[model samples]
Target: MSFPIELTAALTGASVNQLRRWSRAGLVTPEIRPSRPMLYSFRDLVALRSVCYLRSEVSLQKVKTAFSNLSEHDLTEHPAAYRFATDGTTVVVWNEDRFMDLVKNPGQFELVTINDVYRSFTNSSDRVVSDFEHPRENLSVAPDRIGGWPTIRGTRVPFDTIADLVADGDVTADEVPDFYPTVSPSAVADAVSFQEEVEGLAG
Candidate 1:
């Protein structure tokens, strides 16, 4: 799921300038790397959103240190498959009933209550969604579905994938449902308008 820089910025709550800066610093390089058409994968999106959360609490240099710590632990699984928590100084990854301190202690963890995990995960996810100021009511994200890609609610189809069909002039607005039967014309129109607003902000 490769998304353009502008769209990625819109979804991740990171500015276009921020994304460029992070990429150059190797803090969160896009999965699809090109100066002219920067693109990022689903995992990159999760990482970037996590970066946004960390940035609110810590410095970018600290983020670099935390990521360096995380790398040593080997993040081979899908990012959405795990949960994240931080204290503005350290980063941790939680899966099931256990949590690992990725920053201050790279390979150490302890059992934690589900309530504690829920409190942290919701904080991160809430910011990821609310900070975007998304305009379309029909659009949504779910970690259990489509790796948390922004989609038309109740369906796995990405809103951008359908919006692109019109943005690139491959299909007319009315024809959107012809390609994605699950989405309505009005929903597609709103998504295109919202996407244009996002790209305009990047420009």
Candidate 2:
């Protein structure tokens, strides 16, 4: 499913302006953009998160160079599908066999694996009951369901899935119950609010 730019920015912890700039630079483009309202897929979120993390540690030019080098390799999988680390001087992509350095030169700099970056991203996605109060009473987190993504209580429906629908203009917050009869409008509101709060914290 595709999500609007606001939801994409919220989930990825990247500003709307940053997303636009990256899109212009061919770094992370949305899956749907046939009109004024653009939409992005999960893959785009992963790529944007990677870019945001790299830019935080190094210069934008360095991040661009690293991504350019990465494009030449066989690691074309979605950024979320793989793990990565950086030592402030170089970016490293981890594969099943070994880690591939993205930088041009290989020097004797101490390599610091930023595995926490991926962890932070995952943690942000994993919502739970504690994230909200009475409004989110129906929210839950089950490791066995949907690979641990936050879902409605007693159901496998992810909160983001509903939020995405709302952001896409496919449904209004008041009309969410029609799509998910088991969920209340208040719960839907809570889910969206909780995610926005998470995004604010991430930012």
Model 1: CA > 4 A from native: 77-82, 95-97, 113-203
Off by over 4 Å in 2: 104-203
Candidate lDDT (C-alpha), each: 0.68, 0.64
TM-score (C-alpha, index-matched) for candidate 2: 0.54
Report the lDDT tens digits of candidate 1 across residue range 1-203. Answer: 58888767765668999999988887778777756689888668777877877788777777777676655667655453446667667767774456788767777885676534433242443322232323344577567777877788667878788788888787886787788888877567657755765676576
Top TM-score hit? 1
Clashes of each: 0, 0
- Report the backbone clash tally of model 1: 0
> Looking at model 2, which ten-residue stretch has the lowest summed lDDT?
127-136
TM-score of each: 0.54, 0.54
lDDT of 2 by residue, 1-203 (tens): 68788777765667888888877887677866723487887667666666776777777887777677665776575555554556677776655545667774532233334443323233335432132112233467666888777787777778877777787777887798888887766567647765775676677
Q: What is the Cα-based lDDT of residue 104 in candidate 1?
A: 76
